[model samples]
Target chain A: MSTPDPRLSINQGTLKYADLATALRATAEAGVQAIGLWREPVQEVGLATAARMLTDSGLRFSTHCRSGFFTMPEGPARRASIEDNRVAIEEAATLAAAGAAGSTAVLVIVAGGLPQGSRDLIGARERVRDAIGELAPDAAAAGVTLSIEPLHPMYASDRCVVSTLGQALDIAADFDPAVVGVTVDTFHIWWDPDVLASIERAGREGRIATYQVCDWKTPLPADVLLGRHYPGDGVIDFGPMTRAVMASGYDRDIEVELFNEDIWATAPLEAVRRTAAGFEVAVSPYLTE
Target chain B: MSTPDPRLSINQGTLKYADLATALRATAEAGVQAIGLWREPVQEVGLATAARMLTDSGLRFSTHCRSGFFTMPEGPARRASIEDNRVAIEEAATLAAAGAAGSTAVLVIVAGGLPQGSRDLIGARERVRDAIGELAPDAAAAGVTLSIEPLHPMYASDRCVVSTLGQALDIAADFDPAVVGVTVDTFHIWWDPDVLASIERAGREGRIATYQVCDWKTPLPADVLLGRHYPGDGVIDFGPMTRAVMASGYDRDIEVELFNEDIWATAPLEAVRRTAAGFEVAVSPYLTE
Candidate 1:
């Protein structure tokens, strides 16, 4: 029998349209052994029911799909966001608990964009740092790592102030490596000139929690959120980047996280198949084993 | 009478609605002593006519809009882009010849994005470097500097591959600083985490050829090209950035470059007035007389 590709994992966002049960079944039936789950879909499936289904499917969890919009204005809004992240950390712990032994349990933190009517990106970034510091203890207690994912500069205004791996690492450096790390998403950081060096530094520091892959395409959709193409379908040269991640000692599952309307519109099974096929071409060659 | 702001210049792009003569007239009348000319409008008005008009209007030429889409496929396509840039250099020289003397006549080079059917950004960037090497002599002979402008990463796929000031500097370092330099456009690089250091490096290296300012706004227009807001109308903190450019030993015109449908739709004179107002509020404080 052919060896199973242990590193291949699909983020639920690639199958965003499917219900939790259907997507999990499609993933396992396709021989993909792990997934990165989004919070909303898990909530829709009910956390307990989602956890039970994940346990039954025998697939592992890599990282939880994010919760950190801490750039909210002072008072109730900011407090609520911090409180929400605490719950996300708990949910991540639960999700990881149902997975096989040694599987990663990470809560990805996407630093929110500027608060309404505020042009203070530096201020926003500081708040993200404060929020992460506030949550690191909960993350450590829950046995889940908090991975800060730096979105591309394009998303800096409305999505994430953390626009480079360097910035994410700077923020991550303040916390314990076991509790705070950084997620490297190719779609978000392919254009950064400093990324390769940052990746090397991330590896040496033992802080690379998760490595996500998705190609970058152009004439982006009106929403821009739907702009990611599947691996090998766009402009990113993934072989070198993925190899860099592997060299960084990141032996965990390489999650294929995509957010695109066209890919999501495909039948769930086909999406999984396509993702696997893309992984083989764009990502598999970098595997050491 | 109050002293005229020598550093403030109007890039013709901010007056997308005006004819070249009207724009020049409006700019000089508004007490702006310098202008950055776009090639299309210059061609439309006739290059010689445009040069004479500038001299007559007494407005010095800061920079020529752009002329470097060198990422085209090889043979005639690539050669044609090189030839076009040569022409652009000559035109820039003519614009400078008409100036009051000692004014910089710079040609902006926007590194073209991914070649059609090709996703090799590294390859595209190398081609840009090679194209600059080939053109440096012509630019030097014409006494016009070739200024590489690294567009924002959002434009990395369809517009330009030179996505960071550091990358542009790496390319510029290979050629003579007198002939090859880099343009610092705030709108294109405001999100860069390394910008402050990059600006200092450019100053130390003597490559700060032109400094352009425009504000960054979100929910970009359907056509992202038309999404730039006037400075201070959007979220950029320009004071520190402008100060960084000046401290870089860059004593050149600060061109206010904007690309937006709404701004373009405004009356030509009002657009210039608003640009001047924005410069005074967001940028003037940092300029040392």
Candidate 2:
């Protein structure tokens, strides 16, 4: 097999079936220099033990998988979500500090969908902004950056109300760039008319927390969430986007975060190897030139 | 039974199985004042006969159910598509004149998906603009307003390259507003953050050709294309969107176009009744309020 790309960080979502130990081991053994962690696996092992495992594995952590579903009205559920997010901020900071030197203390946020029995999308989006505002101080205190992720518009009703990078940046503008930023994921925003311009703005604003790469193909699976593809496996031309991100002065590890069921069923190490190979073929070239 | 909203037009797609006669009879029997015609059924009866039947039914014609799949590169296929669009424009003018007073000669344009085996979304989009430019004169001569529609981004790759109202308006900017306008469909654009502002801009620019309404619910069907719902059944708060369109001085008949398999399976007249009822509850109040 060809050597893995050094800048490739296998986001744990790609190896969905893998637990904490398996994910880190698979990523490192596949010759990938970095790995992004999910909260479930880390919580399963408990944060302290997860941190120890990361230190021993010697792989860098690119970002914490995610933690931001605060689209609820102001109630106990909302309060609980806010408190849980505070704990997540601490977790992201601890994990980053425990990982290798290049690890980044960034947390991806999938802003929640509209509240149940509600057609108030505008209200839900406002709650996302309020949730971020409530969390920004905590993020700054914990030295973690909350990266708002705009999922594809198909998920706007039930998964995320924040469905555009420009919207994400607009929300991020209220907070300090270091404490709040946006996640640039290709699978979600590749179809956007304003995508390149948004990337340039993100870079100019100094708020691209992490850059994730994946492909989007149609005849999307029954579970739309699992329709993501390995890089170059679908129709997305990564050239302009990758170059735009590069042009934005984002010199961080690039992540491959697949959500396909077939990929999840493959062996973790094999999946990591395949991810790195796809990244090398589809995205790495744009990184350099 | 609740009196049907006078402005409610049942788009033929909602009664997918209905032939032209059946659709018109069902819609008219249900007391709906207007209807939108699809190309297939109209072609089945031949446009002239369909026009006579529409005149006989005494229902106003709201729009021509779409003909614009010109996202391919310059070739025989592109030429064929442009010619077909010209024919469609003539059909729209003929049908509009044949229908009752207040009928509109609007041909809805669903700009086609990326050409097969092509990842060039930008190129495909430009081709759509170019095709529109080629067909605008034919539309103008026929007294047909080509209404450019922005499909939901989920269909961005395989169905329509035009995926935003702003993008549609941008493309229409080059042509006279009377010749090229936009279809404001709630299902496709309700999730958009800039939707209200875009609608206002469309009105201000004199480009609001048609306003179609449908609801979006999640766990989209295996065929995502058929995931739409009647306006009141899903999570969309139509108040703001409906109010925005009303504020734009859009006095044209509003259409309820749906593509759900279940809705299609219903008898034509019942489906029309349900659409009007849904509109009555979910959208009509906002119109006059």
Candidate 3:
């Protein structure tokens, strides 16, 4: 097989079934230089041990997979979510420090869906802004950048209220870009008519914390969440988006975060290799040489 | 049941299996005041017979439901789609003339998806603008308003490229408002952060040809196309959207164009009644008194 792209980072969720040691081993064994970790596996081994294992793997940590479903109103649920996010902030900082020198202390945040049985979308959105406000200081204190991710609109009512990069940036605006920014994932925003402009704005505003690549296709699977494909495997034309992100002065490892069932069913090492291959073809062409 | 909202129009798609005669009869029997029709059922009876039936039903015609899937490059298919749209425009005019006073000759347009195997969304969208340019004169001559309907972004790949009201209005900007307008549908755009602004803009530009309502719920059915629900059955708060459209000075009949499997399985008249009931609770309160 050809050499993997140096800038390709394997997002852990792509290896959905892999445990921490296997995930790290497979990604590193595949000759991939970086991996983004999810909370479950990190907590499975505990933070310090997970960080030490990550260091032994000799790979960079691109980001902490996620932890920001705090779109609930003030109450027990909201308090629990807030406390969890604080822990996530610390996790991100610890992992970033334990990984290779270039690791970034960024925690991707998915603003939760509408509270159960509530049709108050406007209210739900306001709460996301408020939740971020509550979490910003904690993130800053932990030395972690909380990256708000704008999920696909299909997930608006059930998974996330933040459904656009511009919206994410708007919430991120009140905080330091170093503490709170946005996650630009092609799978979620590729269909946006104003995506290129939004990317430029995110850059101008210095709010792009991470740039993740994936592909989107229709006749989406039974579970829409698992419909994301390897970068070159679907209809997404990565050229313009990749070029736009690069032109916006974003210089960082691009994570391939496929959530497809087929990919997860494959061996983690194979998945990483395939992800690297797809990224090289679909996204690498637009990067600055 | 309570008297149907006078402004509520049962979009024929809500009765997916109903022939033109049955759809007209069911809607009129439901005490609904108007309807928007699909070309298939209209053409099934032939336009003249359909127009006569509509006149007999005594319901206002809200929009022609719909015909504008010409997002391909120069080819025979594109030519056929354009010719078909011209026919659709003529039908909209004839039906509008035949319906009771206050009927609108608005032909709803759904810009087709990406050409098979092509990822040129920008190009596909441009072709929609170009196709509108080509069809504008025919529409104007026929006294028909071609209303561009931006389908939800989920349909961007295999259904419609126009995914936001703002984008639709931008395309309509080049033509006279009377000839080129937009269809504002709640189910398609309720999640948009800029939906309220787009609705206001559509009104400011005199481009809102039709206002359609339906609800969006989670765990979208296998065929995402059929996941639409009766307005109040899902989490979409139609209040703001309905209010914005009304405040935009849209005085036309409001169409409830649901595309759901279970609803379609119900009796057509019952489905219309349910739709009316849903709209009364979800949207009617937001209408100008």
Scored against the true structure, residue B59 in model 2 reaches a CA lDDT of 99
lDDT of 1 by residue, B1-289 (tens): 2334677889999898798999998888778888999999999988899889989989888999889999876799899899999999999999888865546879999988888878677788889989999999899889889999999999998899999999999999998899999999998888887888999999999999999999998888888888888779998988778888988777788899888888889887778788888788778888864
On lDDT, the candidate that comes out on top is: 2
Summarize candidate 2's per-residue lDDT along B1-289 as a digit string, tens digits. 9899999999999999999999999999999999999999999989889999999999999999889999988889988888899889999999999989999999999999988899999999999888888998888888999999999999999999999999999999999999999999999999889999999999999999999999989889999999999999999888888888888899999999899989999999899999999999999898888
What local lDDT does model 2 show for residue A264? 94
DockQ for every prediction shown: 0.71, 0.88, 0.82
Listed per prediction, chain B TM-scores read 0.97, 0.99, 0.98
lDDT of 2 by residue, A1-289 (tens): 8888888999999988899999999999989989899999999999999999999999999999889999999999999999999999999999999999899999999998988888889889999999999999999999999999999999998999999999999999999999999999999999999999999999999999999999999899999999999998999999999999999899788998999999999999889888888999999899888
Model 2 misses residue B155 by how many Å? 0.7
Give the DockQ-based CAPRI class for model 1: medium
Q: Distance from true position, residue A142, model 3, in Å?
A: 1.8
Clashing pairs in 2: none
User: Which residue pairs collide in model 1, if any?
Assistant: none
Would you list the rank order by DockQ, best first? 2, 3, 1
Across A70-96, the per-residue lDDT of candidate 3 in tens digits comes to: 878899999999999899999999999
